[model samples]
Target: MKDLFSSYRIKELELKNRIVMPPMCQYSVEAKDGIPNSWHQHHYVSRAIGGTGLVIVEMTDVEPDGRITDHDLGLWSDDQIDAFSKIVKEVHRYGAKIGIQIAHAGRKAQDAETPVAPSAIAFDETFKTPRALETEEVKGIVDKFRASVRRAVQAGFDAIELHGAHGYLIHQFLSPITNRRDDEYGKDLTKFGVEVIQAAKSEMPASMPLIMRISAREYVEGGYGLEESIAFSKVFKEAGVDMFHVSSGGEGPIGAAGRPGTHASYQTPLAREIKKALDIPVIAVGRLDDPILANSIIGNEEADLVAVGRGMLRNPYWALEASQALNKKVAVPVQYERGFRH
Candidate 1:
């Protein structure tokens, strides 16, 4: 009878509750350099005050050009580490574990520099056409990932999640529609992902949990399918990924079909299937607005954890309210107790 309020552990990390706040791009950074500021602190701190068990920071670029937008956060230099450290400390003070999503936007990067992908492909009209990365430069991107992981560790993050999904850099490599290179990287999509994981693991402590957010299905022609994702999951497991955040359908023309809709647990099946194929934990996300549905997925072993994105955004106290509905005790900030007394 594991409910939404039940405690869960992934690797050595313990989550006070099953409710997790999925990373949502705030696009609130100060400038193209991607340095985190007070806005990020206030944003995440508000979520922490809302009683989320875990709050995964938004996607942060490992390199300057890896940013998806000019306002995305980054960790390419030592100066950024202090801001991240402040964020981690603030979130932890509220009893919420904080994790950072380190990523490269790849072909999706937009701004001063042209984007780089496994092949020269464009994301959409809003996205800039990217140049294919050279072999040596690709290795540099892997190094950048390792460096970012090190910075996250220095910032005292509890875990690190590789942004492998959402039609970003890693997704670009994973998707056949964009990754048309014949080299080892483009020829074997799994290899590139494995390398990134290996690099991150090498830089970060072995005890720290490593999760990969992957689109289980591209939902477009010639894009990644569940079968390929399952295979990729196996490789990730062997490479020491602690969990898989199963999200889908970010790989087509911009605003293509399969974007977020009203369906509850739209990507749960992918998590279930991947979890069945691998021994690691799977996180189900997308339209998980109902606590009953979230509890059912966990109770039935469909997913080990449920991530709520827009749902939590619309109602940061969604977890606390859910606990109340399920007859479970939830901690409320003393100042807010009066508001909930009714």
Candidate 2:
């Protein structure tokens, strides 16, 4: 019987447990050159030391302007590769598998001189309206994704996750509410995402599984729902996605109809549904701060992995604490074993 302490395997990657520390941007890149600094090193290494099975690094953009902020991490240069490699080595020493969430912020890049998106639209008044990408330019973005994946592989990451959620560049191309282009990309909403997936796959090793994070339901008016997301997810799967990280909303402002409530394991059901419908593995993330609930989701076969977002932020040792609280015999570091007795 698999539980939170059970080891899980996907392709060539084997996790020590089911507790995943999902990507949450640290925004500590001091030089604004996409290179990660000491803060990133300490932040990720601490979680690895705390017993997380998998620690996914935050949304790292493929290009400088693709970031949500100037401080976000990036993978556009060879110079950035060495720094990420060091972090990956440290996390591995702690026995936690590390992955990177390669992303593009699109119109949400508040600091970009000229943010680019599928269409010339602004997220809101505070954000600048992005210039629409020409058909030829779209291919360039796909190449950038391929380059990013290559860099991740060189950095020694065990897995790769493409950020297609939260109204980012890939999500912008996926969402009909945001993608209003009349070009081929708009004609086929999944085209951009599919191309990106294929591009990233080309650079990945055959043994590594590519994970995609997607908004299963858009909360804003005229946004997509589960059915549409599943359809696009199917396309992505065929295009070479191995797992789905289910999340919701982030298309527009909160509205009566679009607002999804804040509750524990609220997104687990969506993951369950997708897993059953598509016969694919899933990672359920939301307010799953409680160990019992997170374990229950895995025990019930609802999701293959549980990503604890805010809980991990508040406490880097959330996984270690959960192991102790659940009375599961997880291996604590030799130095910290005295602090966490079974």
Candidate 3:
């Protein structure tokens, strides 16, 4: 009988409510040195003030070149830890827990002079053909992942999410369409992601939960779908993943046979499938802008949490508004009480 307003917990991470603000890339860093600036501070802290139970910072890379753009965030260097810590501290003040999505864009790194991938695949004609990582180099990237998670741990984040969806580095390794190598990593599609998961967990506190964002189905033909994803998800679960952020697409361009998910809660069924099939908790995302629909996902036991992406971008206080609309009592700042008077 839980709804969006219910508190939830896993291991050490406790959320005050079920509303999550999923990681959406800001691409707003000014230094081009992969450091988050004032923009990120205001962006995240505002959502925390707006009543989000959990606010996941965007795709932060493990290396400078691992980013999609020069402006993206990175935790490769210890110097970058303070800026993130500042955000996490302010978010905690507002009673919302914060998490960061650590990732490497891989072949999708738009600004890399030369990108790296599981194989030498160009995302498309417009993208550069990527250099495949040598077998030894793949292990090196795993170390980089471990380092990034370490920095996040130092930054005081309640949780960490490894991005394995959206045709990113981890996704590139997971997909047969992009991974054509004969190495052990290619031989076992889940190896890279599994290693990354294990490494991230090593740096996290025993109570801190580790979440992974994974595409449950690839859109392109010949690509793996729900069944294949479930198999690999089980591998990740055994590898120390506490939760799954179920999403779809990102392998290739959507074709006639592989259309994008456009309807509201279109991706909720996929989350439900994984939760039932694997008995693992999942965060249902994708066009879940309506608070009522998001709440139902929780009430129906469809998902453990619901992430509102674009809706949050449009309204930093989307959670607060949803609470009002749902007639659910939620904490509002004393200063903003007049504004939210019912």
Candidate 4:
């Protein structure tokens, strides 16, 4: 049976194992110019050395104002390519394939003078209300996604993940909770995402797989659940998405009754449903820090891959430690092998 330490491959990307370092924002770009610095290079390459099969970089915005904060990463300019290329080359050197999560924070863009979104909605009472995008302007945003994806390709990333979760721009367009527009974009919620996916695919090599991180269930009262997610995922798959990084919530506030379960693997069922319904591969995330639990999800076919977020944050060698804990054989860099010697 497949497990966390087993090899995994999709399209042109080949991984040493199934453990994935999913995109967790570092908020470390202090220059406010969105360039990757030594912090990013070390942050990612260290995970590669730690034996992670995949290291998906943080939520890198397509434009400056699209960022969640001034400290977030961006790809709006050609000047930023070299820094990311350095990370990519170093990650590849250590045997891990890397992908970047391209996203727009939309109304959640805390640092934008005035953020933009599908509708003029505020993320919450604390966020500024965003200006709604016109139909033509929405198309321009799609081009920005296209351009950012082109830069990611040039940077030598193995794959690309469009952030369609966590109340971001794409999510705003997909959910009626935020997309109250009367235009075609609102009428067909998947249109913006589909266009973005198609545009991204155009810039990527044919063998490079496209990954889409989606919120399968929004936790708020009126938010869509598994049924809605399955339907939309089907369309996404048709639009060139090779895999789904299944996650939930980030749409709106959760009342006492609407609150999500905090237990481990609570979101696996959503991933399982999407995998079964769409007959496509999925990466299950959310509180899957335990190696045994992460392994079980893959072994039982709940999901094809597992992402360790905070666990990796606490220890860059999370996969390495997990390998030792599971008694699985994984390559350790010669310099670090002594630390993991059996």
What C-alpha lDDT do the candidate models reach, one value each? 0.85, 0.92, 0.92, 0.92
**Over the stretch 10-90, how does candidate 3's per-residue lDDT look in tens digits?**
887889999999999999999887888999999999999999999999999999889999999999999999999999999
Best by lDDT: 3
- What residue runs in model 3 are displaced by over 4 Å at the alpha carbon? 254-261
Flag regions of model 2 displaced more than 4 Å: 253-259
Model 2: how far is 338 from its true place, Å?
1.7
Per residue, candidate 2 scores C-alpha lDDT tens digits across 89-173 of 9999989999999999999998999999999989988889999999999999999999999999999999999999988999999
Alpha-carbon shift of residue 330 in model 3 (angstroms): 1.1
Q: Give lDDT for model 3.
A: 0.92
User: Could you give the C-alpha RMSD of every candidate to the true structure, in order shown?
Assistant: 1.8, 1.7, 1.7, 1.8
TM match of model 3 to true structure: 0.98
- My TM-score estimates for the predictions, one after another, are 0.95, 0.98, 0.98, 0.97
User: Relative to the unseen true structure, what is the Cα RMSD of model 3?
Assistant: 1.7
Off by over 4 Å in 1: 253-262
Q: Local error of candidate 2 at 267, Å?
A: 0.8
Error of 2 at 3 (Å): 0.7
lDDT (10s digit) by residue, model 4, range 1-342: 788888888987888788999999999997899998989999999999888999999999999999999999999999988999999999999989999999999999999999999999888899999999999999999999999999999999999999999889999899989999999998999999999999999999999989999999887768898899999999999999999999888886422123654778878899999999999999999889999999899999999999988899999999999998899978888898789866
Candidate 1 lDDT (Cα, 0 to 1): 0.85
